[model samples]
Target chain A: MSIFETIRFALRGLVANKLRSGLTVLGILIGVGAVILLVAVGNGSAKVIEESIESLGTNTLTISSGGFGRQSSTSTSSTSLTVELATALADQSAAPHVKTVSPVVTSSSLAATYEDTDVTVGSFIGTHPDYATASNFSIKSGAMFTTDDVNDHSKVVVLGSTVAEGLFGTVDPLGQQINVSGKLFTVIGVLAEKGSSGLSDPNDLAIAPLSAVQESLTGYGSLSQILVQAVSADDIDTAQAEVTSILNEKLGVTSTSSSTPYRIMNQAELLETRTSNAKTFTTLLGAVAAISLLVGGIGITNIMMVTVTERTREIGIRKALGAPKRTVLNQFLVEATVLSVIGGLLGVAGAVIGSQFTIMGTKPVIVPSSVLLALGVSVGIGLFFGSYPASRAASLRPIEALRYE
Target chain B: MSAHRANRPVLDVRNAKKIYGSGEATVVALAGVSLTVHRGEYVAIMGSSGSGKSTLMNILGCLDIPTTGRYLLDGVDVSKLNDRQLALVRNRRIGFVFQSFNLIPRTTALANVELPMAYAGVRSAERKRRAHAALDLVGLADRADHEPNQLSGGQQQRVAVARALVTAPALVLADEPTGNLDTQSTADVLAVLDSLNQSGRTIVLITHEDDVAMHAKRVIRLVDGKIVSDQRNGHLAASRSAMLRDAYSTAVYR
Candidate 1:
């Protein structure tokens, strides 16, 4: 018989058993839906991590002194890291893979004011002129603080986009003065909006000359964290190792135990780890969902076998009417394929709809390739598991089947 | 006899033998049985249970192969044909009706009638036309859209007859076609078969009922895997009684 005719007959057979076919379709639907939803959430989180890494600059690394363990208060300790050590690490001769180093000193919950209006600063940071290049920030209007400013301890500051908008209300704040921590500092430049980088919100902080924040607000010798930029993304590991050893030597930490009091984080490695973690989560979820598809395939085989047994006499009738074995086989196989395909289509629709809602603070993003793969796998499950029952139907002897009653 | 009897017989078997089981459980269903049926002849083979009548019908319908025999169907050596080739012969040259009126359930009368044509790879439009005509022949044209369950027993049996005739086979094989029907339904089915035979359609019917066998122009009686009598229906009453007496004596002696 022609394939189209066989398909028509198979459709009729499925229709004849509506509840059974519907249940089978629901099984496959849940399987395919789970795969799509899990993969979408995985890809969504991966994309978010990738964007954060890009914002942080892949070639950058952060060095924090005496903070290897969670219990370490070395960030607040005055003896671990100083401006002089940061200046030494910034030298190309000391760390050849290093491109630039910016020493940071942060004071949180600082209130800034311009005339009568004021905005609460999330963070007030102190750093050198190379801070723009190290952290991928750029001056939008005015210039960054000069080396002379650092040496002279000039009371000049660069406001981030959020800080500038809040203090001056869209007015050019470059020539304005703002009082930070009860001290006045000139706004030399406004930094461009760089969004959050998982470390901090660059758009909500302010930058000042390192000497000024250390002398005026913090009144401490220790640096908060040092931002280091490698010459290229490939040099991040080399730059991180150089920064780690340089800090260990400066802090008088011994190298015999391979234990350094400093922690170095390479943005590239962090990005890779986060992305791989997302992929692992996706694969685990996909595997669990795939088991359902396998079970659905087994369900199909079971139903088809039951169908074959139940219709033994009908099969005998068809065989007696001159149906070839191939025809009988094709009929059942096509029935199974139709079931899976329809279920897959419904699953795709469900996933697409379900992706619009957020689950656990992350919205799913339906990926076209994963959708295609899920559909392909479901169809494959149908064909792979449908073969046994189809062949059983085909191999039935007309004489015995007719006598089966 | 028709002129086709002198030509190639519609079906011919030479010493057909069928055996079931083996060793201590061995049972020979058909032993050295031979027969020839000509074109356009209506014949019935009557036997009690275990008489091998069903085995002979299966062989005649190409549903089973004889263990030791040469059976020619529509002039082809069906005994030597492979399974696939035999299926083709059954599709193209033979049509079958069963005692249960085995029309596929949940299928309309028309689709059931078109089933054999579908297997023969006939086009949809032509198959539909031929199926409708066949249903009309059995006076079921108006009930073409009804499912088997929706039809009465007599109507369902007529639909089965229509399905068998739709393929225009070389011969029709009916195994107790009226076995499950009431008296009126049985009469209705018999009238349909009688008309088809009168229209020169070749039919081979297997039954244990003397009334059913009496409708055929020729009757063959089987006793314990052997045909003890083969004759025209005018002397069926006498021949059936003699055959039964001989079979009873043989059974008692054994």
Candidate 2:
């Protein structure tokens, strides 16, 4: 038979029983929908992690002193880091991978006024201007501080982009001086905006020089930690080992780590671990949804069986009129495929509606592969599920079927 | 003894046997039946229940393969033909109308008639034209769109008859085709069958009622799987009940 003819007959048979076909395809829709959606979420998270890791200087290695534990994110509390160590690292002859080593010390004293808005925030850092380059900061309006400003130990600070907007408003705050506990720091340049990373909001603080902060902001005896960067991103592992070895030899500390208590986390390794976990979770969720697809196939089979029983006499009539078993099987099989294919299309429709728009506007995300895969699988399901029923219809004894009342 | 027999009969059966099961559980459906039917002959096979007349009709219809026999249809031995071949033979040479009007429910009269043509691979346009013609022959062209549920008993039987004759097969094997019909409907359906028979089409009708058997030119009656009465219906009886059907429809329509 021609394709059109097969489709026509199959469509007629499907239309004859609506509820049965509808319920059957519902399973497949849920299965395919779940799989596509979960994979999308997994892909989305992968993108986020990749970007975050790349933002942490893909071509640079960072070394910190004092905050070694995994829980000690950037909170520099230990007194082990000092400006002397930062100077020695910067002066190292063998540290060819070293780009710049800037000691970091933070002090939190609130209450800053610009115009009329006075917000008492926390977490302020004091470091060299090269910290901007190492941390991937992008300036919206002004430049970062010059090295001369760092050398002079001038009481100069730059505001994070968010702080610049939040405090300075439209007025140029570059030339203005902000008072911190009777000490005034000149605003040299406005640091650019760096949006939130996994750890911290880059635009939520003010940055100042380490020497200036020690003299004027914190008044602590020594710096809290040193932020060291390597020149090339690929050499991070080697650079990391060198930094740790130098810290141990310089700090006069004995080797006391079971698994390197001074934890050195490369962003790449963390990203890899996260990606694998996401894949596993996505597949697990997708498998749960696949059960619904299986349910749909079974539904089709059951309904087709019922149809065979109901049309027993018709089968007999056709057989007596010269229809072969193969022809009969083909007819029923065609009908089954038609029902499944329509249901699969409905599933695609359902996924689009269910995922992106109805399921909080995350649309069913038409990955061309999913559409083709779902349709292919459903067609296969129809053949497998419809076989027994179609065969049963074909195998009906003509004599008995004709005798059926 | 017959003109067609001088050549070759359209149907020739010799020592045909059909047993229900094997070994000690076997029940013979047909026991060594032999018969010959020429073309253009109206034959009626009649019997009480379990007399093997029904079995004979099934065999004649090519609905079952005999366990043992030499059954020839149109000079070709049918006992050796495959199931697929038998089905083709049935469609090309034999049309069938059942007692219960085995028209597919929820289908219109036109579609019911066109169904067999579809299985025969007749294209759409020709199928529609021929199906309409069959419906017109049964005087149900106006009711083509109506489903079996909407049609009266006689109309439904007429639709079945239209289906049977739509392909213009060589023979029509109606197994008690009018058994469930009212007298009027039976007359209408039987008259259509009779006219078609008179047009040189072979027809084999199975019936227990003598009133129906009298409509045919020949009768073969079986009792206990054996032929007990084989006679020409030339002087046996007339179909009084079927005649009453024609009278009732004439009164109703005219």
Candidate 3:
């Protein structure tokens, strides 16, 4: 028989059993839809992480006073990263690649009150004004506390967007005073809103001059960490090397010792690590979705087998009319393929529509390749799963089939 | 009819034998039975249950291969043909009408008739035109769009007859074509077959009914896988020739 006639026959056969055929299609639809949607969610989360990391200036490096494993234990007492070390690293003659160095001391949780409202700040940080530039924090109103304010030990603080909203609500607090652990400080600026990255909320902290915070809340202790910005993205490596050498000389540590009391984390390296981690997560999601697709393929096999058995007499009639075995096989195979292809197309539409809304706090980004792969696999599933039943129908002896009840 | 017999036998079988099972459980369905049928002939093979008439019918219809035999249809040695080639032979050279009508369910009467032609790779337009013509010949032209289930038993049988004749094969094998029909429906189906035979289409009707067998010009009775009698009804042949002469004279006068 002609291919056109065979396809028509197959379609008519499916139409004759509408409920069964529709259920089979629905199985495949769920499989394909899950694959595309879940993978898109994985991709979306990865994009969110990458953007957040990029927001923390790609040329910036965080210098903290701890090393990994054994190195951290032995070197903890030998040399502590202090404000003096931060100052020396900032010298123009010694470190040309280093653009700005901000020494930061953090008080983890401190209750701050404005009038009757009191809220516990997630992070109360003491740092130079340069911390604002390095961390990409922009002032919404009023200006950042200047270097002169740090030298004078001014009792001034900048509220992050979340902190400001909690303490003052709609009321403007540009010049209002807020109490931090019983110490009153004027709010000179409010940081612009930054949405929470997966790790922590960046807009739930307050910033102040290092000298004022150390004198009041923390006393003269080792600086919490150092924030260093390289002059440009390409200068990050050279700047890190310069800072290492300066710290090594001042702290009396030899380069050959293999242990240091400090560690510098490169923002670019962190981004690469996070992106790869996200890719692994996406792959895991894809694998899970693929299992459902396999089950859907199995569903096709089950339905096709039933159809072949039910139509044995019809097959015999066709054979008696002189239809070759190949024609019979093609008819059943085409029927199965049509079912899956329709389901796959609907799945693509479903995934595309489902991705439009945010899912689990992340807007899903559809991967083009996942859509194509799901469709291709569904078609392949139809052909692969369809073969067994079709061949069974084809191999049936005409006399026996005709004799069948 | 004599001129057609002189040209070539439409079907020729030499000692066709069919066996079932092996050794201890062996049973012979067709035992060294030989038969020949010519163009423009209507032959009926009659037998009770287990008389091997069905076996011989199957072999003659190309639906089964004999254990040992040389069978030719339209001068083609079908005994040596493979499954694929046998299917082609069945499509081009033989038409079958089963007892149950065997029309594909859910298909229109027209498409049922067009089936054999479709397997022969005929184009859609030509298939449709020929299918409609065949249905018209069976007096089912108005019911061409009806499915098999929608047609009555007699109409369904007539549709099967239309499907059988649409291919214009060397032989039309009808296996108990009226077995499922009422008396009136049987008459209607048999009348369609008579008209087809009158138009010079070869027919082989397999039935146990003596009345049905009497409709054919030649009757072969099988007993226990062996043919006991092969005779021609002289009276029927003589009357059919008279009818043909009247048709010829009318054509000449017109």
Pairs in clash, predicted candidate 1: none
The list of candidate 3 runs beyond 4 A from truth reads A69-78, A87-99, A231-255, A272-280, A357-361, B1-6, B234-254
> What TM-score, to 2 decimals, does candidate 1 have?
0.81
TM-score of each: 0.81, 0.81, 0.91
Number of the top-ranking candidate, with TM-score as the measure: 3
Residue B120 miss distance in model 1 (angstroms): 0.9
Tell me how much of the true interface, by contacts, candidate 1 captures.
0.89
CAPRI grade, predicted model 3:
medium
- Sort every candidate by lDDT, greatest first: 3, 1, 2
Docking class of 1: medium
List ranges where model 1 is wrong by over 4 Å. Answer: A63-101, A107-124, A129-206, A218-225, A229-264, B1-6, B234-254
Residue-wise C-alpha lDDT for candidate 1, range A1-405, written one tens digit per residue: 888999999999999999999998998898888889888988877777787777779999887765445225344443456778888888888799999888899998799999988999998988888888777788899989898999899999998899999999868898899998789999999988885656566689898988899899998767888888898988888888888788767777676744566678788888889889888987887788778778888888888888889888889889998999989999999988999999898989999999999965677888898899889988998888888988999999999888897
Model 2: residues >4 Å from true position, as ranges? A66-122, A140-143, A160-203, A217-264, A357-368, A403-405, B1-6, B22-26, B234-254
Q: What is the DockQ score, from 0 to 1, of model 3? A: 0.71
What is the TM-score of each candidate's chain B when compared with the real chain B? Answer: 0.89, 0.87, 0.91
TM-score winner between 2 and 3, please give it: 3
Model 1, global lDDT: 0.86
